[model samples]
Every structure is written in C-alpha cells, then in structure tokens.
Target chain A: MRAKTSAALNRSELEEELRAIGRRRYHDRHPFHELLHNGQLGRGQVQAWALNRFYYQRSIPKKDAALISRADSAELRRVWRQRLADHDGDEPGHGGIARWLNLCAAVGLERRKVESLDGLLPATRFAVDAYVHFVREKSLLEAVASSLTELFAPDIIADRMRGMLAHYDFVSNEAMAYFDRRLTEAPRDVDFALEWVLERAETVEQQESVLDALRFKCDVLWAQLDALYHAYVDPGHIPPGAFAPQDESTDRPRRYR
Target chain B: MRAKTSAALNRSELEEELRAIGRRRYHDRHPFHELLHNGQLGRGQVQAWALNRFYYQRSIPKKDAALISRADSAELRRVWRQRLADHDGDEPGHGGIARWLNLCAAVGLERRKVESLDGLLPATRFAVDAYVHFVREKSLLEAVASSLTELFAPDIIADRMRGMLAHYDFVSNEAMAYFDRRLTEAPRDVDFALEWVLERAETVEQQESVLDALRFKCDVLWAQLDALYHAYVDPGHIPPGAFAPQDESTDRPRRYR
Candidate 1:
C-alpha cells in the first residue's frame, strides 16, 4: 500500500501533488512516446499508432456525454458540453475525431481502413473500453478527475509538435493541427476539472480516489503505448489477427520526391 | 474477415474447428506459460502468476451466471446451472473458488490477501471484467461459446499440475488438489458446452461469432500471461503499480530445496 500523505495539504499543495502524479505516470514518459515525439518512427508505425489511438479519441465524447447526462446542474452540464462540442464538432469532418482522421490520412492510411478499426490490437480496444466503463460507473468526481491527465498534456503536446516538425520530413504543419488546438483547449478544460476535484474531494478518501482515478487514466494511456510499442516499435510483434502494414503497391512510385 | 466455412458442418467438424482454435490460441502457447510448464521461472514469479490467475478463476461462475440468466430453456439452463454448482458448490469452502484458495495457500499466499485481490495486476482486472461484460452484452450463443475454452483446459491442467509438482519443491500434492478436481470437472463441462455450440450456432455468422468469442476468451487468458511476463519475467518492465515480490526476507528460509 502507498503511504498516505496527511490530508492537511492546502489547495495549492494538493494541486501540486495531483500535477506531480501526472508528471511521474503520464504516457509522455513512455518509450513509444519518445519515438513519436522525436519523429524516429517509420510511416507505417505512425499510421498504426494513429489508427489505434482513434479508438480512444472517438470514445471521449461518449464518456463525457455520460458524465454530462449524470450531472445535476445545468451549469455543470453547460461547462461539460464544451468537451462534447470539441470532440464531436459543430458538423461532420471537423472535431477531434476528424482531426485524428486527418493525421491518419497524412500518414497515408486509407480513410475506410482507419474508420473500420479492423487492424487495432485487441488489448488497445480492451483498455479503451475499460476507460469508458470506469467513467460510466464510478463517482462523478473520479470521472472528472480522470480527465485531469489533460493538465499535463499541453506541455507534452508542445514538445511533441515541435520535435515532430523539426525532425520528420514527412510531417507538416497541417498534419499536426490537432495538437495546436489541444494546447489551448486542454488547459481550459483541465483547469475546470482540477478545481471541481479540489472542491468535491474534501475527505481524504475522496482525494485518494481522485488521485487513483488519475493514476487509472494514466494506465489507460500508458497501456495503449505499451501495445503500440510491443506491436509496432519493437521488431513489430503484431498480435494475432490485428492490422498489418499493407505491402507497397508496385503501381505507385516508391518516393514522391 | 476470415473465410466462412459453409454453415452445415457435421458435428465432428464443428468440434474439430473449436478444438483447433484452442490449439492455436490458448494460453499454453504464451511465453510465461512455457516458463511455467518448463520449470524455468523462479518461485516468486510462480507465486505472482498464481495470485493473479485466481481473479480469473473467481470470475468464472459470475460469467456462467450471466449465461444461465440469459438462457430461455429449462434444459439449457439446467446444463449451464451445473457450472454455477461446480464453481459455487453446495456448501461453503467446498467448490472451485475454495479449491483455488487452496492453490493460493499452497503457493504461500495468504487467503485474505488473495481474496482481496490487492496483489492483482490492473490488466488482469480489466481483461476479466471485459469477459464478464462480453458474456452479459453479447448474444447468448457467443456467451456460451466463450466458455468453450474449458474444452482445452483438462490437458493444460494435466501439464501444469505435473510441471509444478515436478519443478517446485515448495509445492506438494496437497497444495494442488484444485487441478485434480478441474481435470475431471473441465471435460464434463466442456462436453456439454461443445454440444451446446454445435446445436445452436446454425448460421455461418453465428458460427463465426462463436469462433470469435473463443478467440476473445483466448486473448483474455493470454493477456493475463502477457501482464505476468511483462511485469515479472521481463527485467524492470513492471507497470506503474502492480504486485511486487517482497525483498528476500532474512527471517524465512527459502522453501525450495
């Protein structure tokens, strides 16, 4: 069992402790992450990563919608509604899912192929589904606390966006438009979420549950990278009956350059 | 998508295909499994595997109950109810779960600690929960088919029981009473389940779904092994917070000769 720090932390100290949890456990610390941010991964690996990650992105709004539906106050729901809008977008071909689709397209994955999730690892699906279930079933505070991983995301996104553009020839400014938007959006959302947690988690048990929720969310993110790293990055150990990179078509030129 | 065989297979062919699925995808093929059956793993690694696996064993009746609740026919429910009986038993401390607790006790794990599942891997929890959810939400045919892994369990149990007794001096005949029962119980259970699938999966799609359910069950079993391998077998690759072997205790002598 982890040692319990006294529940006497002031609001700022508690916030720092929560942010520290993110610093230590977030997916940005994972190895595949370094490969991704540094643009050291091959095109097919990137495509595989994006395709699998699309499952996570697509489920976010559904989880958030579940959170919204459970909220008693219209004001809380109104604040939560922005998350739905951000992911679902005003119309088709726009929101986070669409932006993720664009990343897949930029990496040369066919739209239909990406949409079908035909090639994703089973572990990836299980991990993402587990997250959706966690939010739907757990206390609302824990659900919101799970989203607090976003508090750490803006910095990682900055580092990743800069590193990818600087190191990779194939990546373009347009390819990473999703990260650009996330930089602004994540902090605003996370700020609200963090405050909601600090207010609701008055008891030590509630605070610990919120902390555990963040830890669980970190595991969800880290597990995805572990699957990708195991399957794509390290000698490409694809699990049985998951996506495989298509053979280069002889009809197409080897190099666009 | 896999090629669909014609819906009209003779009963023998259906059974063969089902057995073939087990041959290809069962946890016996997992690397940690080989270490287990070959006596290559250390005692701590062995203890960790047994501890995590208890979660799967404990969940079996609940998954079976979900299937029993969904069955419409008294005869079908009668067949499935046997599973509940087999696991839960007529009296306390007399069923499969109690048998599993005995196995854990033999491994030097405390009964309360094992039952608390405090030492379990997060992946183990998610994978088993996913199996329960799959049985509850999927078609009843798929739910019944998922238990079809029992068809292959008798052989694996034979191999595991023999290997553990031969390899580990700490394990005794009394400790492994769980397998003696499973060796008989599994075949009886599998025989009924195989007949159930053969009788019910009348369409190609239904057959395919049944096949897929077995595959999913295989993945669930395999994923638990994967978590064990990654955390215990692999050097320094433990997930953020999972079971850790206690530092070699000076007070207690090593159990193995």
Candidate 2:
C-alpha cells in the first residue's frame, strides 16, 4: 500500500513529463511551418492554409469566452479576459481575428469567402469544435493547461515572422502583423498559464488531467495540419464542401456576383 | 425573388426528393464498403476500421434515446423506440453494439481497449457528437428525417453480408452477425421514419427542413468515412491518441499490465 502511494507520486511526475511531451512533438516543428515561413509554398497553398487556419483563429476567442463564463473566481476571469481583447480588440479593423483576415487577404483569399469558412476543410471544423467542447466540458485546470501550448508558440512565431518577410514576395510587414503581436502576447499568456498549471495541479489526478489536456490540444493542432497537408499537399483528396484553390492566372468569375 | 420561390414544392414531392437524395449519395457506394466486402483490406486496416467505426455504432443508441426523449407524441416515440432496442438489445451480449463487440473480438482487439475508444480518431468522436447534438437540438420532424439514412442502409447490409462471408477467409457467419440483424431492423425503422416525415412535413418550410436533415445525416456518415480514409486508408496519417495499427507478426512486450 505504501508502494502504491509512492507510485501515485511517480504518476504525477509522469504527467508533468507528458506536458513536456507537447513542447517537443507538436506541429510547431512541422515542415510545413518551415515552408510557410520561408515563402516556399505556392500562392494557392498559402491561400489554402490561411483560409483553413482562419477557422482556428476565429474559434479561439469564442472558446476563450466560453472558458471565461465558466470560471468561478474573479482573478481567473480577470486573467482570461485578456484573450477576449486580444482576439476581438478594442476597435473595428483590429485584434487577432482581423489580423488573421489581413493575412488571408494577403494570401489572395477573398475576405468574404474566408470569413464564410465555406472553403475550409470539414476536418478543420471538427478539430476546432473539439477544442471548444474540451474547454467547456473539461475541468478548469485541464482547460487552462490546454492553452499551455502557447508556451512554445513564441519561438515558432519568431521563426515564422522572419521567414515570411525574407521569403514571400506578397508578404508585407503590415500583412504579416499577427505574428508580431503574438511574439510578446504569447509569452505573457504562456507565463501566466504555465504558472497556473504548476501552482494549481496539486494532486496526481489533477496533474494527469493537465497532461491529457495538453495532449488533446496537440491533437487539435496536428489534426488541422493533417487536413491541410492531405487536401493541399500530398494526395490532395479534397472532401466535398472544402475550399478549392483558385487558379493562379484567374480571378473569381464576375457572374458570381 | 420569384425565381427563388419557384424551387418550392408540395409535401409528397419534397419527401420523394429527400429519399432520392439518400438513394444517390449514401455510404453504400463508398470504396471502403467494396474493400470491406471483398476482403481486400489487410487485417490491420480492417481492425482499424472496426475499432474506429465502433465509436459510431456505440453512439447510435444514445442519439436515438435523445430523439426519443425529445419526441412529444406517443406514436412517434413508439416508432423511435425500436432503434433503441435494436442497438441496446434486450440484454447484454445480444444487441447491435454487443454484436459489434463480437466482431471486434473476432478481429483480435481486447474488449476493454475497444470499449474505451482509446484508438478511435478524434474526428470520429466529433462527427458522432455532432449527430447527437443535431438530434437533441433540431425539430422532431427533422430528427426523424435524419434517421432516414437507414432508408439506404438495408440494401447496403444485404450486399455487405453476402460479400463478406463469400470473400473473407477470416470472417464467419457468427462474426458477421451484426449485419444480419440490421438487414431487418433498418428497413422497418426507415419505413416508419419516412412515413413520419411525409405526414408531418406539410409546409414548404417544413419540407425544406426535412430535406436539410437528410443532407445533415449524409454529412455525418460521409464525415466518418472521411476521417477513416484520412487516418487508416490513405497514407495513414493517424492523429495523436487514435488507435495505431499493430504489427501482427511481432507482438510487443506488454508494458501496461
């Protein structure tokens, strides 16, 4: 029985170790990131990625608000409110979501079409919805731990920003502006979230839940890219209702109006 | 406005059109069916498909129960109750879900692992959950209409059962018993559901809503296969936490037990 008790502590250590698993294995290191940053992807691929990824950006604030509403403590809610502002911003034509729209436009997707998410893959929608549902249903510690993926995001954003400006002809400092803010925002966000997990995950079970949350979040991120790579990169088996890449030489037909 | 209005149809015609949609687009024609029936899929792929698809079958009774609970009329509830019985069975080890477990055991998966859904794709869970949510939230008429996918299921089951026993060396009549029962159960349920939709969808708006329900049901079915194809059949881009196919020839040393 004492050995079993010691095993429980070992399990908590194992759970913290699994949280570190996300830092190494998540898509922050995927080859597509390298291509996306280096501007090596064709305009069509870039358009596809941005259009598909817009769904993720659009959902973040909604899920964050969901988490905010579920928080029982004022301090927790107060800490969570920053995500809402970061995504929605204080004024029109600002915030993370708008910045994502600018990225979409820069990549050549029509603003209306991008906003509609008509062209986004169903898998992307499913993955994002799964994330939202996880936040709503899982324990608050796990919900907060899921966002710990942000702990690793700042480094990727730095790589992406430098790579995009150097490689892509269409990219401008203004159009690639989302990453610039995230460079600072992500670290601040990550610090608070990491501290929250380390401080609050006091039990073996809580530690396991937090670890599972990060793993779930990693799956969420990886599934999005898997859909993108499958649809746009490899066999390119585009499912029905997903976004179709526009012909490089052509534009939206006038008759669509 | 007049051109848009012209597409509206009377109730009988709308019911026929909705059934026609099921006839044309259901999973009966999916290549995976051909593969499964012909015994062409390798054992691992077959195991992967069954493990993943169990998530769908397991959720059916829950969704049916939700629909049954939402139903206002006794006659409607009585008709819907058959689906619950079909899936859940009169006792343990007798119903569709149990029969599905038998199939899993025949394929060599441990019953506990299969039950836990440890290996199922994340997208499969989301798609199944989406169906349950649709039934819970939509109008009763639409929920009944969604089950009209069963309108197409009987024919597929006939082909599947005959083909599996004829072609698959590993399969037995006992192993494929789930399909045998579904042959009778699906048609009976579908006929009642079709009549229910036809009788209730009197308004043009109601008719359109029923059609939309069938479309949504089709999406649910198609999305499940899409996830399967993406994960197991294509390049096998298995998402994190999903079941990974094991090598049959080399049994790994058991670490968990």
Candidate 3:
C-alpha cells in the first residue's frame, strides 16, 4: 500500500503513485488474464468472458454520459462528449458497444442474447453499475480520476489483441476491433483526464481521493475477472441464471476440477 | 430463472414466487455459507468474513434512511425509522453496528481497523454500496421488495447462530447477539415490508420488478460471499491492500492448494 501520507504529492509524484496502483491492482495482473491471454481458456470460457465483458463495454457510454452530466465547464463536457460518440457512434449499429456485440457474436453468442444481457453474472452488473454510480455521485475530480484506468488500458488491450490472435482460432482481426479502436481512443481520453486531475487536485485529501478513485476503478475491473474465474475457471460453479456454456451441463456441479 | 411472466399474479402466487427465489438464489445457498456454517473455514477465513460483512451491516441504516427519504407517507417513514434505530442505536456504541464490532472483536479484529474499513475487500464495498444505491434510487416498490430477502433471513440467522456457537471455540453468545437480535428484528421488519410490497406492486410490470428486485438483493448478498470465497477460500489471491491474515505472508502468493 502507498503509505497514507497527509502531504500533497507533486505532479510527477501523484502520477507515479497512480501508475504504482495500476501496476499492483489493475485487472491485467489478474490470473484470469493469464489464462485468457495464453489461450488456456476453453472456447466457452472465452465466450463467457466476452459475453460478460460486453456488459462493461455497453456501460461505457452510460458511464461517460453520467460523467458528462456532472461536468461543470463546457470544455470538460466537450472533452468528455467524445466518449459518448466513440462508444455509441454517430449512427445505428456503430461505435464501441456495437463493435463489442459483434465480438460477442463472433464468439458464437446470439445477437439477441448478448443484447438482452439475460445471462450476465449478477456480480458483473453490480461492479459495472458501481463504477457508473461512482462517477455520477462522487466529486467531479474523483469522477475524472476514475477514468485514469485508461492510462493503463492501452497496454492490456495490446497484450490481449496479440495473445488472442496467436492462441485462439476463433479470435480474428475483426473480432478484436474493439480493443484495436481503444488503443488510440484510450490515450487521447486519458491525456486530458490526467492533466485535469493533476491540475485540479490541489490539496492532500483531494490527491488521496484521486488515488483512491483509481484504486476503486481497478477493483471494479479486477473483481469482474475474479467472478469469471470463480464461475467459469477453477472450482467453476456458475451462479443461478448466469450464462452457462452451451455444451456444458446446466447443473453446474460444484466440484473443483 | 423465475420465468419472466408478463401476467400479474395473485397475492399467494407472488409470495410463493418470492419464496422460490429465496430458495434458489439467497446467499444462504452460497458455498461460502456451507463452508462457514459447517465450520470448514479456518479462523482467518472466518475473520475475513466478519470484517467484510461488517460493511454490509453498517449500511443497513443508510439504506433504510434512503427508503424513508423517498417514502410518501408518514406511516412508511415511521415504520422504516425503526430499522435505523435498530442498526444505529440510540447513541454511540449502542446499535447493531457496535454489537457487530464486538463480534469482530470476538473474532480478534481491531475496532479501529474494522471501523476504518481499511482491510475490506474492494468487491465487498462495491457490492454493499450497490445495494444502498438501489434503495436510494430504484422505485419505492422495488426498494421495499428488495428487503423481502429478509423473509428468508431468520432461518439463515438461526443456522448461523447454531453453527458458529457449536463449531467455533472463539465465539460466544454475546458475540452472536447481533444474529440473535436480527432473528426477531428481520421477521418483524419483513412482515411490514412484505405486506407493503404485496399491496403496492399492483401492475404486472411492478410485480415483475418486485421479483427482480429480490433477485438483485440476493445477488448483492451472494456476490459478497463470492469475493470472500475467492480471496479467503479457493484459489485465494487477496487483492492488494485488502486485509491479509497476519500469520500468512503478505505477499499473498496466488497458487491454490
């Protein structure tokens, strides 16, 4: 844990501390990622990941909209508005969520099932909704700081794109389009957010909230994977009403294999 | 999944459906509970459960307060006020939270650490906070329906009390007082809330929402155990900065035994 210091950190010091949290707490460090990246995950496992992840992907525009709704200045709103357009797109069946659904479809899930989110792990909904609620209700600076997870996202996205392509025949260039787009989109978004947070978080307590906000976001991401690993990986016992792999028995016998 | 029926059911049918949800989805059925009630967990695991559960215990009054804030009638507010009193007590160190702290003390956790919630699992915070937000934000019928899980609580509390007292040497009657108290409190609370829900949820859509709300609350409880089971039980990898057992190396090596 970063020592709970009362003193305010300098620009670089705060940035370093944020990066350290990413190194330690980001979901990229989660073991499920190792399984996912290395292609040790079965096809159904990958499908479950995509299907559940689609909830997070789909919530981006909503979360961004919530943040935009809370933005005080036109410049801040203007900067954040790009997120909505990027995620929701200018026209029907475009943008990140559409691309994500396409990815889910490529993984063999039906379009309607993915859209309805009928099969989602309730834990996934809880975590993602918590993120959106955090942005909408917390102080705007803390809201902006929550998005700093994007500062670390590009690397994980790149690693995911490379790993999925090499190990899984089911994954294709088109299927990985969501991450490909994020590679460019995330950096642009993070640059403005990081600068805004660094400039605005002037006091020690504000700086700590900034750091804690990022930590909360990391937990949001990491907890999703933990749920996946528990339900679909080791000791797999998919919760009642969650997505069970089609080929597997729906009984979800609770034994560690 | 309770087949999503569009047709409104009679009172008895709705009640039966609600009870069926509890049968299938209550956190009491979670494996972590089986482990807990059966005394399969180590002391550190038990401590982790209490420390994490304390977050949920502390939030009950806030949730009731939110519900009361939204209530349109004096009777509703007056009835809900009792929950606040039960949890928060008349003064400092007097309510259910204080009693919970004593339980935590019985399990050997520090009062300061428990109060600060410094050692809490981030997932625990996320799940608990989601429940509070649901009550604050969702339609009042849904909020009232969410408490219907209390309909199932007395049995679980009874089992928990019996099992903990019989299985764990560290436990005492006084330590179990919170559950002992909850057994009476939950049934009384559920009686009023369930009757209110049965009366208010008049439309088919609203009835469906009531069932869904209970499902959501069960997920809230079950997700907490999922976090605990993942971090303290199988394939344990305590996330960075969460409470790690003192006897265990803080490194929290990821391999499952």
Candidate 4:
C-alpha cells in the first residue's frame, strides 16, 4: 500500500485487478439494482431514484470543466473538452443535462425545483460533489483513473434502459436520451482513460494507485445506490431534508414515479 | 452545476454545505457500518475488514509525502511534513503504520502478509490511492480541502473503538492505539485544512469546489465501507482474487485471522 517495496506490475496485471474490482463491486451487482431491473420497486421509489440521480446528471458539466481547467496541454484540453459539450451542448434544451431534465419532467419533478436542488437528497449531493471534486483535485492520471468506472456504465445503462422502459410507464425511449447518448459517449471517454491509465501508470505504486482510482470511482457510483436503497427501498429511512415520498400512508409500497 | 451563475455564497453557507454533506453522506450512515459498530459482524467479516483496511493505514505516509512534494512554501511544507513523520516515524515498527500493523497482529493477521498487501481488495486499493493522488495532483487548496475528511473521522473512530472493544473478543486497548493517535493527530490536520479552505477559497467557484472536494473525500471513505459491506456483510459477495474466508463449508461462521 505504501513505500513501493515491490517491483512494478505489468499493465495486464493492473488491468486485471481493475476489471476484477468492477466485476465484484459495480452497482450493477447491488441489490437495489436487482430490485430496480427486476421491476420490483414501486413508482414512488423509482421517482426518488430519478430525482436524486438528477443531481449526478447535473454535475457532469462541472466535473468536465474542472478537468479541462486542470489539464496543462492544449491537445489534452482539446480532446477532453468535448465532454463539456457532450453534457452541456451549444444551446439550452439540448444535450445530456436537458435529456436528464426531460426524464425528471416525465417522472413528475419540476425542472426549477430540480435545478434548485431543493428536494435532492444529501446523499445525492455528496456523491455528485465527490465526482466533480475527484476530477478537479486528483492527478491527471488519477482523474482519468476515476473516470474508468465508465467502462461498466454502458452495461448498467443498458440494463436501466431495458428495465425502466419496459417496466415503468413513465419511462420512454425519448426520456432515455441521456442514457442513449451515454452509451456512445462513455465508451469513447473510457477508451481514452483506459489507455491513459495504462500508459502513464508505469511504476508499481502508480499502477496500484490507478487501479485503486477506478475502484474508488466504482465506490462513488455504488454508494449512490446504497443511498437510494436506504432512502427509498425496503428500509425507506429518509434523512432529514431529503426529498420525501409523495405517498407515505400505506403499509404496502406505493406506485413510484 | 456549471458556469458559476451566482455570486459567491457567504462563508457560513459554504460551511453549512460542507457539514451537511458530511452529515448526510459519510460512511457512518452505511448499514454495514451500523453492523460493524453494533458487533453484529462475524469474526471472519471483521478479519476481512481489518486486513483490507491495513492497506489504507499503510498509505498515509505516501499521501503526506505527496502533499509535501506539491506545496510551494516552506511554511506549508513545514506544517504538512509532520504527517509523514506521524505515519513513518524514525524507523521500521515506530510510527502510525507500525501501530496499525500492531493492531492487525492483535486482530490475528500476520504483520508481514498485511504489509505485503497480497490479499487486499481492489476497492481498498482504489480508495487509498485516490487520496494519495489527490494530494499530488490537486491545487494546494483542494489538497487541503480533501484532507478535511479528517474533521469527521474522530467520531467514527471513537464509535468503532467503543463498539469493537466492547463486542469483539480479539480486539483490545493496545489494538486501538492507532485510532487513539488519530484522535489527536487528525484534529491538528483538520484545523489547518478547514482554516486554510475557509481563508483561501475566495470565489464562489473556488468555495464550491472546495466543498465538493470534501464531499468527494467523504465518498472515498464511504466507498471503502461499501466495498467492505458487499464483500463481508449482507450480500457477502467477495470479489474474485480478494481475500477469502477461512471456513466456508458450514452454515455457521468461524473465527478468522
């Protein structure tokens, strides 16, 4: 863990460690996900997940901008800068954020309130802010390492797209534009990060750190699900000042948004 | 989330946001944590946690050294340099890492194997490296901001100490010395980081970034717990190539080292 006591691991070994971490710990394996994809959650639970997740969606542009600000080279900045455009776009009502907002609207959350983050869970804020901070405050290698969680995102999004669209009437192919774009965009971003981590993390300590960075990023994603599960699933323990479920009177789970 | 549309918030508001993030998103809220603190985890689960956490304890010196390497001023370096000493001491078996190894030994893991990090989870590796890289790559302000997670650590450590000592047969007063030292050491570090962050982050963007940095750090800690919980607690889904339990054939769990 420290002192660089051993010889450097080859890139393949480091990659294997990272892939193993993802396979074992990705949120796709989380029980909340099992509940989600299997169509076991109610509408209100689904609504709560979407509302809280909006905080994450809204944060991507800030994270991308921070990465751009930190990169020293023009080429690096130029290649990476596309992320900001991909999330924010040239005009209002376009791109990923807009699509996320459309999803929120489809689920019955008001855009202004969502923008204000008035009902956003503290867990959502913490998780999203962590990501933006991870991009801004880690080394370029580490920052890219953190983004490696994207390697697994396409599968999760596809699961989500298939599950939500099929199970929830509120979900539509149009509302899933955010995920559709991500299916394309995340792969490109991940390819860059994977190559960057492989090439730059040359020493044993550096390679271990890079592998760990991806795991840390996975935790970031997984923790969000834990929060959602705690707040909206079986336990339903909502924290103070988080978004409240609209229907709380019944012993049985209510229909979710 | 982008463009910094509003003027800077008052410092109190910024502080509130930071505190709120911690209150809501810190690992103290994770259920696996609740289980650990309540002494509900089996010995094997506890062993797995201690073994993996050794990786975190081992990385502190490297993170401190990285912070020292990135700072510009003698004053900043002088203040931060104590961290390396606190963790490394004058020789082998002298400092925080040594104390942590002692704790590992007390908990029944071999000090040598723990140091080897041969059985560490990929998640554990990822979270620890993120902290080290955060120190090495981020702006001085953001680096300090990331360390502010220490501000919340004392309470959690105190809880763990009380719970583990009271509940677990193998844990003892000597084993808790690492956390005891942290109870003192963390305060000094947190004071510097909190004061530095409050004083230096002048713009709204800077302050928000600082706040987000702390939140990012909380996620890092929380993510580690998520990994621990998934591997050892309720789902008990250990990742491939991670440390395995000593006994798996019976319905009942067994004592582990």
Per-candidate iRMS values, in order, are 2.2, 2.4, 1.0, 6.2
Candidate 1 vs candidate 2, TM-score winner? 1
- What does candidate 4's lDDT look like per residue over A37-137, in tens digits? 77887667877888888888788778878888888878778878888888888899988888889998887778888788775665556556667777877
Off-target runs (Cα >4 Å) in candidate 4 are A1-30, A51-86, A112-159, A180-227, A234-257, B1-38, B66-76, B110-113, B116-163, B183-223, B235-244, B248-257
> In CAPRI terms, where does candidate 2 land?
acceptable
Q: Judge candidate 3 at residue B75 and give its lDDT.
A: 98
- In model 2, which residue pairs have backbone atoms overlapping below 3 Å? A119-A243, B119-B243
* lDDT of each residue in B186-224, candidate 3, tens digit only: 999999999999988777888889999999999999989
Which lDDT tens digits does candidate 3 get at residues A1-257? 44667677899999999999999889889999999999999878998999999999989888889988887799999999999999999998999999998899888889899889987998899899999998888999999999999999988998999999999998899999988999999999999999999999888889999999999999899889989998889778788788878654554523334
Model 1 per-residue lDDT tens digits across residues A1-257: 23677655667877887988888889889888898888788776777788999999999999999899888989889999999999889999998889988888988888898888887777788888899889999999999999999989988999999998887776789989888999999999988888888988887778788888998999888877777765665535466667776545653422211
Question: Which candidate number maximizes TM-score?
Answer: 3
Q: Is 1 or 3 the stronger prediction by TM-score? A: 3
C-alpha lDDT of candidate 1 relative to the true structure: 0.82
Model 1 stretches astray by more than 4 angstroms: A1-10, A234-236, A246-257, B1-13, B90-92, B247-257
TM-score of chain B of each: 0.92, 0.92, 0.95, 0.92
- C-alpha lDDT of candidate 2 relative to the true structure: 0.78
DockQ per candidate: 0.39, 0.42, 0.77, 0.10
Q: What's the distance in Å from true for residue A177, model 2? A: 1.3
Give the per-residue lDDT digits (tens) of candidate 4, residues B117-141.
8767665666676777677777878
Query: What's each prediction's clash count?
Result: 1, 2, 0, 9
True contacts kept of each: 0.23, 0.28, 0.74, 0.03
Q: Between the candidate structures 3 and 4, which one is better when assessed by lDDT?
A: 3
Q: In terms of TM-score, how similar is model 4 to the real structure?
A: 0.64
Tell me how far the alpha carbon of residue B15 in candidate 2 is from the true structure, in angstroms, after superposition: 2.8
lDDT of 3 at B23: 96
Q: Which pairs clash (backbone N, Cα, C closer than 3 Å) in model 3?
A: none
